[model samples]
Target chain A: MTIGEVRENPAPAASVVRQPTFVVEPSKGWLALNLQEVWEYRELLYFLAWRDIKVRYKQTILGAAWAIIQPFFTMVIFSLFFGRLAKIPSDGIPYPIFSYAALVPWTFFANGLTQSSNSLVASANLIKKVYFPRLVVPISSILSGAVDFVLAFIVLLVMMVYFDTLPTWNIVWLPLLLLLALVTSLGVGLWFTAMNVQFRDVRYAVPFLVQAWMFATPIAYPSSLLGEPWRTLYGINPMVGVIEGFRWALLGVNTAPGPVIIISSLVSVGLLVSGAFYFRRMEKTFADVV
Target chain B: MSDVAIRVQNLSKQYHIGGTQAGYKTLRESLVEGIQAPFRRARKLLRGQATGAAELDETIWALKDVSFEVNEGEVVGIIGRNGAGKSTLLKVLSRITEPTRGRAEVYGRVGSLLEVGTGFHQELTGRENIYLNGAILGMKKAEIERKFDEIVAFAEIEKFIDTPVKHYSSGMYVRLAFAVAAHLEPEILLVDEVLAVGDVAFQKKCLGKMGDVAKSGRTVLLVSHNMGAIDALCETTVFLEQGKVVDIGQTPVVIQQYLSSLYDIADYSLQNRVDRGGSGRAKINYIYLATSDGLPLQQVLSGQEVMIVIGYESQIPLNHPTFKLTVYNNVGQPLTQFDSSLTNALFIQLPLRGYVGCQLGKLPLSARRYRLHASLDNGVELLDHWTGAYSFTVGPGNYYGTGRNVVGLKDVCLVDQTWQLLENAPEVHWSV
Candidate 1:
């Protein structure tokens, strides 16, 4: 007999001994987190983040120096327009260092949001071709911004020395504050990236949203300009807590944004959980739509 | 360890076709739809109250309840025409897209190469891209590092390893991409038509590597239009048509089924087919198949007399018209051609509108389905051409009247011959 005939007859025997290792089906409900899958693909996340950093500065003469240039120039512009021209209050600190402190985290947050929001559409080819936790795309994009944040942070340290303003013990909260910025950026980024897959308008809307959000945050002016209840309400924008926290921790400002930070932290966490659920809901359709 | 490598049950995927608000709607379209949505819902509710049924008419089922299973260490080939959901099947199996319904269970780590150079960044160096692409294909960093030199040597681009991939030649780039993919070492490898790229030598190398991969007892699911590769590698093949499994069995059998289905002609129509190219000065309105006796023949026996009738409409009268007709065998290989100019039928006057018949006293073909492609050209300007305009089948026939059937990989023609015994001469040569 031919091999096909022999194999066909033994198919039942072959199937009886089979045990599947992975089963794929339509995702149901909101709890399709699949965190273990992401953890297993962690190396891919690292490589992707590395790729972004490598490709970003490739062929550019300044290389990683562009990271510092971007925020430094923005700080110069803000200091001239808001600090010098408008005489904005710096909460008893020098306005250049004051705004520069907030701008450090603000730049990180803004860059993270812009990159993560467009990550899905930018890597549509990878998403369509391979099978990975789609979350890795936006997450890695947000993480790659950490490189720029670090480069820009070094420049901020140099500026702090130039201004001769030493930070106090509150600098210990810097890591926690940075984590808050990371979470808040990823939270809002997930929603926009997921929507961007379907509606391409999110790509156009993101930069505008970042611009408006900058004004809404206390980067140009201290949160001390407002009173108690209104100030706490303004903390609904997550960057308010992150920027103010940066100023308080780095500049040792006397404003003490206690209630605002608490409210902003809660709001940021809430955005993350809801945004993740929405992202998971739209994840299955990414390959089909994108 | 289980014997079954993959199992798919009742898998289906639906797509909305040409709907104003389906599948990646733009922001403007979404906004417009959002504005009109309330009115649409109200109208739908009113219509439902009247007719008790409201159905949207834009959806099409790309795959419909398709079911199949593949055993471990088996190399299975999926063959189909375009839009047959072959890619869709691979996509669903690879988890690139979730199925709308049903479940596919994979027994091993599935590494899918849907396209080579999937995530290669042009700005990145070749070495960096190798690691990046390997990681994208689910290879661990340690695994990629261990096989790094082997991959580079296999790609034959060791000299350009540190250069940006944008500086590499297209051939070199494809080689590196395919090398990384081939060395992926996943228990189950899913490849989709990626071998169709690169030069002939590279393609041969890829095929050889794939053969080696199959021999090493890894389950491979491949989707390709290359019948030679499929026949050489796969023991069993699945034939899909219109998103459903039509046949799944031995490679040759399933391949023959897929080939014949291309010319099945049950629902085939030449009208309104947009796959033709040329200036449409003259058009073939209809094509007909008939026997020597002038009877329309849907099917004919091998070595029988046949005629192909072509009816045309021309905007202007033509002079010195020539017609060329080519017959392609079951595997889409062009076997023979009958050109009017080559047969000394050139320089004939042609009217603006008339039917032309090309007759053959005896059809020199084997028993198989053949596709017909026809084109008309004048001496100065070409008129029109239609590819795959019609198809017909040739059944088994006793051309020699010996009551013997010619079948199964035989020559595609019946040649008359005489056999003589050389018994007297053989006896004289016994000394040797």
Candidate 2:
């Protein structure tokens, strides 16, 4: 009955400790996105990502080869439909290399979005049972996609060699383009992930969203077909810049990336910031609702 | 340098109750509610009412104004009945869920074992899962690496470490998971009923490890229904009832208080108790404890005559109805059951409404609080089943007439026994 009267004392022993104290309470105002806490849990993030990568390829016949096969097959299908059937222009580059280049980052973005959006629900066990930065779940899912992207990138290089269309020095911009793709995926993925926790309809909607988004991006076709303002507006879908930038950089395509890249970069960063805030807002409710 | 490993002040968690749907609302329910919101508001406005029964505020506080402080190197036990918010308190302190009001501050690296192997992937190998589960429990990779060999050796699964966990037997899987958790080495540990799994030896090992952890000057908060473990391990105990702390003191005193409270409910009316389940063709009305001579009894001594009177009603006539009365110990483990059908008393006709009494010549249970669960069923169909329908206390008595009392006995039951010794005949039995 006198539990409240218990006096606090200094910890005994002379060992130096680095643990930080924390206060848990209901959200009162705009919560800070404690990036420091997430940084401290960075090792957990690495293990989680490693687990996802290992589990994805476990008990499989093709193993990591499946990563390459997914985008390669999608590229074949897009080439047949858009290039051979619809006669869609590819800015004078071979259609296979053009679409394959776009699909490399596109697959990474799509897979990252789909996986990260469901990451919280999928790891509901850990979310409810243990305390960790919930952001680790979605971030690890996105990070795992980087492995798939790297594997598919090697195949993209092979395709470029086969098509006899090598890249110019523009390929130096590939890492920046990959980073943009990552940011864009994580931003939108965070929003969908948080929403998925409340309404599971987001889970079923993600695949359709990815499919619709792929069409909206200029994967099978060139963005050059659109005019100036429309092309600029098309960059509202951040993958437009990523895919266009990939084509421009990898295949030495003539697609102008100046205004669209700026618009898409701004959009990607904007989505990242806003989505992170929204995700953090819903973060406290996740353990209860999930 | 704060010695208070955990401090909770006025911490509470509110959960909505009494609705057609509860907790997580599915999309369909939300959609329907969304569509009907305007009409519901209009009706409320017309009635000059500000709220409805289905409003979100129709809530029950699982933990209300609870305040507790755990000092360094203290192993505190939280003892309470089911739904007493013991788990909720641990969950709040562990930061798995945010408290609805007030705050809880933990001054150390808190490792919570709310469940063992929480994030273990069945498809991953045992070695891989160790790293994964350790990380999920907030252990750094280097920490896990340092303890990897120790964990594997402790689990005794070194031979099968490379095999996927899904292929391991249930026991092996649990051992590996528990080994990783045991090596977490957090400054504060919060465990909730995780010892209920695994075999007896493994549980003993876990308890020993927990004891060592406590002795190493780290704080531990354990929530368990096992009075034996609580009495053995905890220096202090907190008893909760209906979201409020009823007692907080030495372990033996609090546990005794908890046990005594169980005997306070002499008669339980089963009519409106919503925790019952079954087809509802027949429903239990009321249950009471009595003596063999039909005298109402509240508490009886062990090995004394006792009877359980069950009043029930059936919508239709039941033939050869089986009535089962199961008794469980204080920790929710079923001690024994008495089934009418199991005996030779079969093919008995039952009226639409009547009272059925099960008379025991001598209650073989030891001195402890026990729960009664009753069910009325036909051979073909279940009519009604009430869990925790009633609870009673069995005080100690000299069942064998040995002039010795078994009050405060820890064993579950008492058995009659006799021993005889042959005088002066066993001196030459040592031939090799």
Candidate 3:
């Protein structure tokens, strides 16, 4: 008949514990990125990425070698077709080593894009049952790609040794170039994955998008084939700059990343920032629709 | 050090359904609609029919204007029937989904245990999954490590801790998951009906761990249909029905409201209910409870005579038909059954269109709600095995006397028994 009033205690000082308090409410406006909450679950991100890497290699006979083998075989296929039959020029370098350099970054970007795009839907059970920054799911999937990139990079090193190609001062730009590829992958991945949760057509569109994106980049051939402002415009695809930078950094190719690097960096940062906002915007409906 | 742990404003969430927004639509359809949207708007404007009044627009407000608060170190219970917004309220509090309108603010570190071992990888080792599950439930890496040995010891999976959980037996798997969940120390805890799972020992273990959490002075909000647990732990309970709060008061008062709101009349139309099995040759139309005088009965005492009336219509004539009526406890454990095959010779055959009344001499059930399961068959092939028929409630009062009673009543069933003292003692025969 009556609502129970909370009885006030006289000795309230002993029961009051000082701790951090966070409020949850409906989000307003366009941008709702909670990077601090994501940072709080950084260890969870590490464990998730670790779990993905561990599970990917488990029960496979070839194990981590699959990472190297995946990029190696793709490079072989491109060389056999584009180099042997199509006679595509490799900027005065051997086609195998040249294609291998580009494939390393290309495969990393492609894998990161595919995986992170499906990450939210893939972890729907976790999202529905618990609360963490949903950003961790996609970000962790992207982190796992970095491990594969390291393993696949070893093959590029071996191929360079076989061709006796020496590294140039451009090699110093490798880490920054790798980061750009990651940013671009995450940026596009967030868009596709967020839409994928609602429409599911984005799931089928992803592989097609990656395939189309691969050809648009200069993977088998050199970007030097393009002249003038066209070369700069090609950087709009983002991977063009990444692949060209890879070839220039490791093989010391004359086709250096000039205005393309600037364009790629700017576009990738824009994609990363914008994609993050869009992902956060759609995050409100993920538990229901997913 | 705020006294209130959670303050929920007029939180409301609306869900779109049954139209272009009913379920997930493909991108192609959405793109086509996007492309045609402007032209369709123009045509609608020309015709003056743009408001879509002729369309069947559907939406569900899972939670509407729900407001409540729990103070520091206080335990609150939310009780409701299925689809009563109990789970939705918890989901909103845990930040799994944002409200459509209004807001809710939660203080302290919140740990929501809606499902056990969420995000656990089967390919990972038991040791690995413990850490993984702990982290997902919001425990820190160092905290999981500190309790790692205790959890493994509690789960008794130390011998196979390094083995992938896919190889563990289901029992071991749940034990490991529960161990990790029990160790999750948070400032505020939101628990669903996760305790209503596994074997008796596992439930006892969960209750023990929950009691520890309560004793440790943490804020807890539990959503469960188990009134016993709620009554024992929570001083205040909130009753929700049809997406709105019906009452929020002391445990007993709200629980009384919850019970009175269930199965008070012969309300369900069984003919239209789809959750059933077996052939449809003989279908049950409706079911209800009645007294011996054929009066509609809502509830009965522990020792009162009860009659279960089942209405059915058969498509063809049945010879030597078999019928059954079953009683189940509130938690859905089957208590007893009255099968016609045991006494089928009483009647030559069941009628094609009529009511079947299986009368009970005296109901020995305790004071609680009960559901029914009934079936009918034309002698050999099963016709209908209706699993969840109309439900009824038993009494909070006395039973009829002057009858030999059943002994060893396990508190779930009432059995009238006599207690007497013997005047003489018999000599013990101890032959060594």
lDDT of every model, 2 decimals? 0.82, 0.83, 0.80
The residue pairs found clashing in candidate 2 are none
Candidate 3 ranges beyond 4 A from true positions: A1-20, B19-56, B265-432
| Model 3 chain B weakest 10-residue run by lDDT | B45-54
Chain A TM-score for model 3, please?
Answer: 0.93
DockQ of 1: 0.43
lDDT of candidate 3 over A145-234, digit per residue (tens):
888999899878887888999999889999989998999999999877877676576789889989999889998888888998899998
Better of 1 and 3 by DockQ: 1
Candidate 3 local Cα displacement, residue A111, angstroms: 0.4
**Better structure of 1 and 3 per lDDT:** 1
Backbone clashes in each candidate structure, one number apiece? 0, 0, 1
Each candidate's DockQ score against the native complex? 0.43, 0.49, 0.42
**Runs in model 1 with CA error above 4 Å?**
A1-19, B19-34, B37-56, B264-432
**Candidate 1, A12-105: lDDT as tens digits:** 6545655677787877656567778889999999999999998899879999999988888888898899999999989988888888898889
Best by DockQ: 2
| B176-251: candidate 2 lDDT, tens digit per residue | 9999988988888999887655776887788777778767877889988766567667889999988888889898
CA lDDT, candidate 3, residue A12: 53
